[model samples]
Target chain A: MNNVVLKCQSLKKTYKKKNRKLVILKDINYEFKSGHVYAIVGKSGAGKTTLINILGLLKKQDSGKIFILNNDVSKINENKASEIRNKNIGFVFQSFYLDPLLTTEENIKLPMLLNNSLDKIKINERVKKLLKEVELEDRETHFPKELSGGEQQRVAIARALANNPDIILADEPTGSLDPENEENILNILKSLAKKGKCIIIVTHSKTVREYADIVLELKKGILEEVSRD
Target chain B: MKNYLILILKRIIRDFKSRLVILLIALILLLGTIVSINEKTTEEMLSKETYSKYHNRLYQLVKKESYETKKKDIKGIPHIITILHEYNIASEYLSSEEFKTPNTDHTIQAYTADNLSLPKIKYGTNFPDKQGFYMVCPINMYPNSNLSSNNINFKITNKDRIDMQQYLNKTIQFQFENVNNMNIKKESIDIKIVGLYEVNKHSLEDNTCYINESAKKYIYDTLNNDLPSYIEKSNPEAAVIIIDDIKNLEEVESELSKIGYRLDPYTIIDPNFLIETKKINKTYSLILSIICVFLLFLILFKDTKNTLKYNKLLKYLGAKDNHLYLTNLIHNILIILLAFILSLILSFIYRGLLNIIIYFRPFLFSKNEIIFSITYLFKIFITIFISTIIISILNNVYIKYKLNKN
Candidate 1:
């Protein structure tokens, strides 16, 4: 029996706007096993980001049962959710979302820094290794402003891997990068998946879907498995 | 815990590195120091002024006089001393030199029996023996002069001129002749110059003197021994008394009046004067405190508003509510600590400057040393701490509500 790292049963979220309830996610049932790369694809307002936010424990569903590592997450408080997110999940934003004040190395080490589970020496060693792995060891001291789009996203990738999270949630990770930079980020995500990390990418890019073992589509608040090739 | 604190500290240091926050912190520190030091110094000045005024107004010796016979009534007299003994009252004998001098004409010169050992002596000691010895005079003769000169000239008889310098160690013949042809004589008196005393400059009374109790008794004896019946029936002219409670001087006067001694109703010193002055000082201190608190509140309000804005931005950076609150608290605490230390140094410097002013201009401090009073500093600290906590809590609650609402 394979270990399922995360599962969602009948997850639903709604937003009230101008006296109308707009359903963002509806009856979404999904199971993510360890060591698999999944891609969620949709157009604008298809609720892909909302699904990813719920999966990353950054947002609360109106009604849902979310199980992370066999623990019910929907009943957890914000602090506990944040702790679980910090320990088990990592996020990559479309804009890189690197703290502009910190350097690339500091940005990459932020998760571990916030968690305070690792010493400075270990953090530095891990950051150095990540910098080397991302092919940007020379750019460790460079701030986010000093790095290119590709380099910043690579730093974000390194930050996502800082805590050795069970799952990586990439929300349009390559949306702001050029074609060449896009390939660079895609290859990094694929490489992380090859290392037995579950990679979930929410993106509009068909190229991102090509890298995933399973491609899921979110349409009108309904999630459907489109292809498993 | 240590690692968490270190991380928080690092983040705070980074936040403080911002030029705006750094400048605000510096300004808060500088302003707090100036206000604290000024408040402390002002409180000290006010306290000293009030205390000095109170001390001067309260402490004094009063002597009341009236004749033993021809009973009269006195009531509601201010600051009077009543005597119970009738024979102890002695006559005022003017020396020949003092009688001839125009400067001593209007001066009310009185000689006491030196029974009451008052702390502040106003020039010239009591006569050594109770014999015919007489000291020159008290400072009340020349109340304005603080000079220490002992030389005084006096006339002994209508045809005789004697200087006190010549009679210092010799036996002198003195006579007391009343209007009824009765004469009292004394011989072989040695006069010596003892210690001199100066009255407080704030004293309102004129020239006064103290003679030996024996000398006073001798003069009284001489006047009463050979005097005629009519002269003996008349009032003694000068009387002296010791009072128990200085505060109930009016009651003493009424008590004396019941026994036939009439006192002139004149206020020696205003009793409520010191209390009124202290009330004024307290009012000024209260006003100053209110102004300080108002200005402090204004500064704190503005600081808290800016800090709340920064906290909002920090929250978006993945900081929890506690982290945001602690960061702001640490920042303010650092500024307050720095300001306190700097203010202490400034107060020391101010005290030194005051010392310099006092040294060259001794009259400025009224001969008192200048010292930095920290009583007001404690008040300021408590005020600031209370105000800071209140403002911080209000700001936190407001910001948290606004953010959640958003």
Candidate 2:
């Protein structure tokens, strides 16, 4: 698509266990576009998360190219990767990895802090705005444990949105939630998608697949288009 | 930046609180060990400091055991580097008197009051440049003062020095009686008064006189009050040697041994004293080192895991490796600064508490100890800096590697 946010080509990864090579991703290719929800579906250990992490620039691909926002990310140094990630890409893990010691407000402000691009006043203003967007303005003072599952996931979503990144990569975003929390988190992801932001979610849920604009299934270390909704 | 610092600080506060007891105990014990050891070393240094002040750069050559078999010749202090001379025989001022009957000479037969070993002249000039006939009237001192051998000899105090100041540039007749080997002979000499030395220079009632070679003809022994000092009354039985510097003591000793000259216990300065003092400090420092090393490992290992999550979180937030490294550097530096300050405070506290017990035999710090302390503190700071950098780099690399692996 013309609005492509991330594209991967011939990506591969492997590990050695007792001198035997175990390949994870083999010559995988994919394109992620803006203004759509893309769901990656696969069984456990099917390399769905691996593809997502490689796409997120969290891990290196063995022999291929990754381009984020039309620039080749593979040859970029660590500083550039961090810069692109902070400025353009956000992450939401299935565990809703909020800092346990921090309040919801602080959790949401963490990405912005790491990015180090925003001033305190701006970050504070942005944090307030994100809390309102996630409908957690009144819960800003509550720590992660004090929040419900749905509330924690919503906080994570707000954290992802803190830097207003161009893309959101959520790995099994609804994997650990109850049906209600799952539905709530799915709606949030779908809302972000509707707002013309790219949302990449790795999930095993049919409900998540139903809501996605595109679905890709991983098998034997490769991606195949399962459907286009 | 502000937000990042606040977050890092918040994490540190939380972690520190969680491990407050262990951290505090470890820090206090670690710093206390260094400080306690420093305090001990300081005291030891100060104790030797006074004695080392006059002797730090002094190296002496004693008569060889082999020479004692010959016993035919005595080599007294040489005039080339000679500041003062020692006379085994006692002398008496036949007439003039300031303090009273006295003997100030310790086993240290005599020393020339050079600018190095002797204090500034409070009254007259030094003895005459030529060896004809000159005398330096020592201040008559009470015997028990620290300058004399414990309590047996005479000593001159500040007051005696003031009284003796008038005797400067005044001639006095001295009677030297030789009673060696039961042979009795006497010589009377009218010595020119050249100068009066600082009275406090030798508070000991050392009946030592600075005389020229022309006056050496009268170094005879007296009958009544000559304490049985170790110096032989005759010359050629003992020789005085001066070392250029204390650091060269080893070389000088080796050289002197080749010439068959042993270390003279009779000399006030002994290189062995300085060596012994260093050995003591080294022993304590080794103990300190063991404790510090143990603490260093405990701190590093304990902190490695605890900081991993924070490190990962920062990295995830798009912190460059340098930023992370810098942050870790500052964090470790803060801890080290705290520990160092705590060590200094602990040292003073320990000193204050322990100094009372050591007050009786008060030892003052010497120039060498002062210089050593400065160098030692510099070394401590360099160590802290190096350790902080190393720990930060190693820990950051390790955490990054582990996180990447996972």
Candidate 3:
């Protein structure tokens, strides 16, 4: 009875490599529901990252229809796409892209800065809540460069949730972390999905697949759901 | 909006140190161009207004031929407050009957002019009017009976000289001579010595005397055989017209020119000259402004490039192109506003320093003084503001393109 937060139909993406048409994804159709973690696993050349980019609205698909919350957003312009991204989608990259000039709290407050509906007091309150949620409330004033790899990733996660996005698209969110930090990030993502957020993660890790509620494998420009005992 | 402004302020302060040196240089350049153009133009305009209001209304009507301008010829010319007719009479024909000392060493010349043209009188005042036989004699020259041999060296004392005061209010007989058709005619008149002028060390003005218009006419009558037909030739050989106001100068000049009288401006400067100088300064300031704009572009370009990483991050965080654009705009505006304020302050300091220098060595700057005005400051602010906006937009476009590409 869970609601479908994101759905894609007949998605197609291609790249030209050395004057040859190389197909990355073709006819990708899926409906992602809330309260679930969808792990997309693939080989190095498989199009897992490309699919996640398309789903996150960070990259344009050559041909497809994308719907978020029953609204068709496949042909919307960049500005509208950005509004959707700000209001509905959040992204966590593997590199942990944090503004070096801004402190941890300021980075978390960045997304809300563009949201006119949120006043200063509400934004500050939300930033503090996210900082505490990511267990970095004590490091709110620390800049990215001053934090450790795990701490920086925690700040990035807090930033990803700044506007309380309904859908989280994480591409190798823990790829650069140690096992201990990776476990911590995975647990946090799992908790977010339990709270009715649609979490889509692109990764090659076996542990992430085990943690996911539904695991999909992308191979040879096709997607196949894998059954686990 | 409040949040956006806070972010902008924080970024500006965070990047303050990195941009400090270039910002300072930009401030100096902006202040230099603004002060240079504004001060120069203000000086030119103020000087012209002062000159035109006080002394530039005098014009000499040149004589084209032996044809003299009759009083009837300039009867209808508006703003002709005065039409001065000046003439000179030889001093050899002049002798003070009561004083009895005649100088054979140097000739003393007597001339007539308007009161405005007369030199500063040390002992008495200028002629009250052109009528009557009034005269202002040089303290060392007239009444040769009073001068000691040492006084001839021009070691003339000031107005308090007792010997010079002796000639005041005294009447002296002037003998005038005329040669007509090989007939020598002579006449004499008694003229009063009313004033004395100080002998200037730099000129031969001490050997000269200033006579009234009536005395000049008496000499003219004696020289022309006292004939009424010779009266036209006796008109002032040269005439000077004084305009009542500056606004009426061109009209009066055109009227005079239309009447076949060639007028030479004594103090009124050519309007074309000022226009040409203004054009040159405008172009100069424009070039400086362009350079200032280019400098700002470079600064913004570098800053945007440096923050390209952050911009990319913001883009990934769902910032629209215009959102990023607005951020860059606010950033640039803050810097430009800071530079504008600093430049204004520095320009005032620059003007103050130049004034101090001029005060110490007045001859260096001469008549032109540095004048500061709010209009100039407003002009400079508008220029830099608009230019910074254009530069920011251009910089924004480039940054937008680069962000999309990356």
Candidate 4:
């Protein structure tokens, strides 16, 4: 039996520019399942980021149905979307948007704190494990600015995984890293998938595409299966 | 929940030192408004109390023509009495004449004043009943004794006041005609001596018996010499006036003019205490209000500009729009609440300093206070609400514009 965690069907989005319309996403159908890594590779303006935003419930599709674990959430209100985003979805960004004032461990612990689901003792345990998993246990007390770009990205990844969501959405996760840090980040994403969590990465990097269980190309407002690794 | 409160408190302490200067500006401005409101209210109340307490300094005099015409036509103390009484201005009446009481060769000054505007009693009750129609004799109504100050100094050896207390509840007859000793028909009436009052510097009288207006006709008859006058017995010898307030002096004078008194160019005695105090209180109160509102607005403007940076990062994290909104509402409310508390402390300190100085210069402030009325409470809530909304929107919009620009 196939377990689908997130899927979008016939997704469409449009932007209005003065008197004209610009179509961003059209006739896109995809399914992301458990325990797999899907890499969406595209050029700079290929609607990859827009699709990831739609799938994460941060933005609404103009015309389509999005199913997350059997629930149609294409047109959910902002409050309901916030609840689902906080409880079930985690995001990792290229720029490593950690609060500059908070320490590394505090950054990792922020999602759970906002969610208010786990106790202090449990959150502490989760923070330590995430710190060790991302290879930043020694730097847990350091602030975001004190770390290198790769270390900031690792803290961002750990924050994304803090609430133990079933799926992780990464937008250019390795785009700003050195080759060594990029490889280390990929190994972390791959390890998460192996541990039965679905990972979706939107990137322009060929190394990320090679590491994916499935690779898809987004071009001309459509997504197509390009290869299987 | 507790953790959230702890975080909020930690954020407060962490931010307090850096924000203290602007916070003090906001606090002082807000407190100016509060203390000004108190000062204005208390001053107004104090003025009104002073007006009511010493209103008898005002007097209304009638023209001789108006008095004579009304006496011939209305058969009473002229139409002005009824008119003044109807308008609630003449709360009580005062008339005085020298009269000899019953079978005794003793004369005493007599007047008419109702319970409301009567003289204060030193020993006995003040106008024992609301409609008490009796006489109050001074204790010094006897031979060679001028006990005007209540401590009896008798030029004669017989210092007693003919034992006036023994005559309580006893009838006293008077020849109720005009005192001018004319051949008018005698109209007699019975009066009872009921109470006695003290003599003081500001006391109404020392050697008079006070009665109500029901006895006014008999005293006026005495002016026609032991007989009832054919026309209304001339105008009252004097009328004691009490005004509602110093502010109402113009209205009272106008109303008196309408009742046929010579008020064409009425000379109004300017109430010195009320005028000066009102000027000082009103000027300071208005200045405080203006300074407070301006400083409070500017402080909020500056604070919103400064804090927008931190809030944007929280919004970027998993915080919803409402999350950021609530954070701002709580944050601004907390600051204003602190300012409000400090304002209260500042007002108390002001009162304390005023009290310290009051002993040396007594007229600086009165005992009237600025109590928290429902209206004031409502104003506080409204000011807080409106200010919070402005600060919240300013912070959110400016941050968004700056971020988008970058």
* Interface DockQ per candidate: 0.10, 0.41, 0.47, 0.19
True-vs-predicted CA distance for residue A183, candidate 4, Å: 6.9
Q: How well is each residue in B1-406 modelled by candidate 2, as lDDT tens digits? A: 7666666656555554434633553454444344445544554453443333333333334564432432322233222233223342222333233333344222112233443334345567665555466666555423221343444223244443324555566665554445667886664557676765544322233444445444543343224326442234444344444443345556655655665666553445444655675676666545554555456556765877756776676666667778877887776665655555555555545444444344322233312222224344445445555755776677778877887777
lDDT of 2 at B370: 20
Winner on DockQ (1 vs 2) = 2
Q: List the residue pairs that clash in candidate 3.
A: none
* Full candidate order by DockQ, most accurate first: 3, 2, 4, 1
CAPRI grade, predicted model 3: acceptable
lDDT of candidate model 3 versus the reference: 0.72
Candidate 4 residue lDDT tens string, B1-406? 4554445444554565425843674455455445455545554544533333333334445465443353343233321222222112222222212333333335455555656555555445545554435777765554221333333221222343455666667667654332243555545566776776654322323345666565654445443344466233434422234443456656656655665654321224345444564576556545654554555556656766555665544543456666766676676666666665565555555555554553332333533333322344335535555656775677667665664443
| TM-score (C-alpha) between model 4 and the true structure | 0.56
Ranking of models by TM-score: 3, 2, 1, 4
- Point out where model 3 deviates above 4 Å: A138-142, A178-183, A204-215, A225-229, B16-25, B28-53, B56-61, B64-280, B296-311, B322-335, B356-369, B372-406
Task: lDDT for model 1, please.
Answer: 0.59
DockQ of 1: 0.10
User: TM-score: which is higher, 1 or 2?
Assistant: 2
Off by over 4 Å in 2: A1-3, A7-42, A60-67, A72-79, A98-159, A174-196, A204-229, B1-49, B52-83, B88-116, B120-252, B267-274, B280-312, B320-345, B356-406
